[model samples]
Target: MDTYHKFAAFADLDVERFKHFQEEREALSTLKAVEIDTDADTRLTALTADVKAFKTANDNDIKQLKQQINASTKTYQRLSPFYEQRIALLDQSEAVIVQDDDLYDEITRTKTTQLNADRLDDWRNRTMVLHHQLNKAHEQAKLKEEAERAREKALIRRRVALQQRRQQASLKRQRINETKAYRDRFDNLVVRVRNRVDTLDFKVIDAPIEVINAAEAVAAQAFIFTTLKHTDSFTTLQKSLRDTDAKKIATQVQKAATSLWQQLERLPDNQDKVEVLTKINERFDHVPAITIDGATLTQTVTEHLQKTKNAIQAHEQAQTRRYSSPRPF
Candidate 1:
């Protein structure tokens, strides 16, 4: 408790009782010196009462100020958690800048003398705004992340489709190339077989009955094989017609060679039979699996023909001599 300064009017007053006359005398004396004419006792009493009222008013003001400071402190305590939570939210967002440190520094450095409800309310409202901004940033970031994920998913699907398309194209190209190669090989085989048939020497035909028939069969086989045309797929053509025709040509040529050898066995040893055999052997040279040694056969046939001619002439002279009369004898 601090004591206030005493009023000058009561400085020399009696301690026991308030003497009105003495106060009046003093006030008058003081007034006379200041050259003022006024009621002494009345003025002194009024002045004293005014001083008392001023002190009372000042005491009331001090008490009301203390009460206001206590109320503000309680309000700040109630709002503190909300303010700190908003600050935490802002820190998490990294998008909102609360600047709480700057505010604290400014207040601390400047020596703020008061804390009030108005300032606390301002802090509360400002924190709410920051919280709202942080929420908006969170929503926007979420939406952006979802959009990016959708874009990535769509890109993956497009890439997969592209890869599948590439694979399909590659497979189609490979099939086309394979088909072309098969066709080329088939055409080449056909051309070769045709040319071989065309060049075959089917000119001479004089031979035994079986030999002639066999030669005719071989000729027919060659004609049919050479004239056969390609059909749908190469595999089908080879399986159904081409392979069959090729086997038939081989069979006929083999049959012809067999028949010719049988006929040669039956025919008498003469130049005519030898010449026919040579021609047959030469024609079959173009056929597969047929070989001929024409030079050796011809040499052998010429010697046999000369020997038979000489034997026939000698027999006819002996018979003529036996049947005629012996004129020379």
Candidate 2:
């Protein structure tokens, strides 16, 4: 009966140990669904090591207990269920450990995949930003090149315009010089003609016919010049030449009137003188009215002729009275 009570106490002790192992396995199983972190990984490793230690210890204890149970067939038969229970608890513990290990491995793989995906996204974003910057730089460079080309074209155009302006200015200066030379030559010719006209003697009666012809020739030449240019200077030269010709004509009329008066004074008979004077007056009638020194030459000739006629008549009357009065002898 004492041996029976000892075996019963051992069986109760083994049952309590089995209950403790089940509680430990239940705790390990709870870790299977824990949130993954450094602390969780450490806890899983510690739990896995603890489970291995417990399993090894349980295996040794079971081996020793089996040896002790085989030494007594009665103890073996009585503790068989407890041995099976321990084996089942070890198997359940191993399964729990395997589940926790799988959970940890899955969590680790998921974290590594997420890290690789984040790296890829970062690389792509950086590449896109770099590409955008390169494109912007290229566009700016293109714009700068276009602006430079435009400026170069503008500069070239300005240079061409400046060259053309310079050419035009040079041509204008040359034309002005040519015009001035022409004007100078014309002025010199006019001056020489005026000098020649100034030297003529138009007031003298016996002014040589050759001189008169020369004067006329000079006036014709001056007229030709006037027709060519027709400036104020040429107009003045023409007027001077005309005045010279008029003065020469007036001198000729005065000389003719003086010669007629001399011929009438030399006549012996009044009738002869009358006839001569009548012929002279008839000839003078055809003469043109000409002015000399502000008086008309035809009017002066008429007054002189009238005075000569009166003197001749008076002399004739005196001669007649002498012949009619008793001879002074």
Best by TM-score: 1
For candidate 2, give the lDDT: 0.52
What is the TM-score (0 to 1) of candidate 2?
0.27
For model 2, residues 85-164, the per-residue Cα lDDT tens digits are 43443354433323345432432344321333344344335445555666688899999999999999999999999998
How many collisions between residues are there in candidate 2? 0
Where model 2 places Cα greater than 4 Å from the true spot, the runs are 1-127, 195-329
How big is the positional error of residue 131 in model 1, measured in Å on the Cα after superposition?
A: 2.6
Cα error, residue 117 of model 2, in Å, equals 5.1
Clash tally for model 1: 0
TM-score for each model: 0.34, 0.27
Best by lDDT: 1
The whole-model lDDT of each prediction reads 0.56, 0.52
The alpha-carbon deviation from the true structure for residue 19 of candidate 2, after best TM-score superposition, in angstroms, is 65
Per-residue lDDT of 12 in model 2: 82
